[model samples]
Target: MTDLRQLRHFVAVAEHGHFARAAAAINLSQPALSRSIQALEANLGCNLFDRGARNITLTAHGQLVLEHARRLLAGSRALHNAVSQLGNLQAGELRLGAGPYPAARLIPIALGELARRYPKVRVQLLIEDWASLRRRLLNENIELFVADCRELRDDPLLSVEPLRVRPMLFFCRPGHPLLALAEPSAADIAAYSLAATQLPEDGARRLQETLGREPLPDIQCDNFMVLKELVRQSDVISFAPEDVLTSALVGGELATLPPREVLPRKGSAYGLVSRAGHSLSPAAQALRALIFAGDVVAQ
Candidate 1:
């Protein structure tokens, strides 16, 4: 088989139309470079060049081989770049999984920052429950997950970094019964049905643990936009991330409970967590570094 180095030498010589100059450009002696091209031609069973005592000219076969050789060299350089830049935070897809509301905000912000710096890299997003997200990551379905750290509970299969705290806000249609109250207690609001994401296990447990009872939602789904829509149409209430609710609040489609001193600014502490011990692709790691470097700060 024609070796990559051999093809490289042949293509360089073809482009420069002179072996001596090609060898000089590549920091090799002309004879050594000639030998490499000769080997490549011999392996391919074709004469790639017609050499005079002083100058080398392309054979008809040289034109065809030169085309393929240039392509091979270009691809080889691309392969090298793809591998090298992985560490430089420059390229590759970041498979991301996240909770809907947080994902709505964090994913957009992080991806925008990633795009500005590494525009060539792509991002694939999926919103799912923590259990499903964890499962997908273990199966190599995703590279990173923006998850609520509190839900992770000491699993050795993951690595996490805290991003920001999210505070939960209750939402209801304007003039809903509980909204009229000066300060409604959990029970007062509890009288009305709860409309929550009802995420599998993890989110469910956190919700019940907070309210001291399993919340029977008036509606449930994994979509944040749908959850907001439910609150806008009826008296349904959902505790959602502040960022996701921004447009709704501004449009008079929803409202918040006064900030709870007990809840964090981020009612839930969400972070970027990797699956177990898997090392990230160079591009993914680069994006992670920029994300943590405050480059993607809460935009």
Candidate 2:
């Protein structure tokens, strides 16, 4: 079979119409150029050129081959260019997942930056609880996810890169009865309706231990903003990372319940989670960099 190198040599000799000039143009010796064309002709079972006293011309078979060769070479160049674009993050798709918190806090910032820098890159973001996100990742529905990693850290099938820890707090509307207490105990806070997004297994266990019962949300929502609005309108108490409530806290739309020994001070441990041995695509790597950098900026 004829190879690209041979076809290239054949095309060069055809264009230049002389063995010596074609060899010089292609940076090959005359003998090497002649040999490559000869091999191509032998492989194709047809003569490609007519040799004259001072010049060479293409035979009918050579004309057909030249047309096909140019098309093949053009297609080869296009394939290389597409691969280069993907490597540079200039063109590709990023399928990513995020738990409620990071979807609300971290992902938007990173996605904004990614869009600004690489407008050609398409993104599909799935916002779900950690367990669902983990399932999606393992099932190959997404490249990676950002979520609470407490349960996932010990999994032998996963690789986790922890993000900075934030503080968790229960908050309600400013004049909610709990804030009137100097320090409300978990029982005191639990008396009222509790609202929250889905919790990780460890988080639920801690909540159960603290409240002395199976923790159930009166209003469970994956969207924190909706939960925040609910908290503002009613006496319901909700817990979230401190940063998620920063605007509400600053604007006096909400106030945190005073600290109690029973409540966990540490927030959810968010991280980047992927299959242990799987490699991330270039687009995923670029987005991951922006995510880490956005975390720094948040701090």
Could you say which candidate leads in lDDT?
Answer: 2
* Tens-digit lDDT track of model 1 for 68-180: 67656655644554575655555545567887766667677767877887787777889986667877676555777876666674779888777766557777877687767
Candidate 1 displacement at residue 238 in angstroms: 0.6
Q: Report the Cα lDDT for candidate 1.
A: 0.71
Top candidate on TM-score is 2
Compared with the true structure, model 2 gives a TM-score of: 0.69
What is the lDDT, from 0 to 100, of the residue 146 in candidate 2? 94
lDDT (CA) per prediction: 0.71, 0.83
Off by more than 4 A, model 2: 1-87
Q: Write the per-residue lDDT of candidate 2 for residues 1-299, one digit (tens) a residue.
A: 87888878887887888999999998999988888888898999999999899999999999999877866664454354347556567776677899888987789989999999988888899989888988867656677899888888899989899998888878899889887888888788778888888877667777877776665666789987888889999998888888887888899999987783556547669999988997777778888999999998888
Residue pairs with backbone overlap in model 1: 86-282, 89-286, 165-266, 166-266, 166-267, 166-268, 167-266, 167-267
Candidate 2, residue 12: the lDDT equals 85
| TM-score of each candidate structure, all chains considered together | 0.63, 0.69
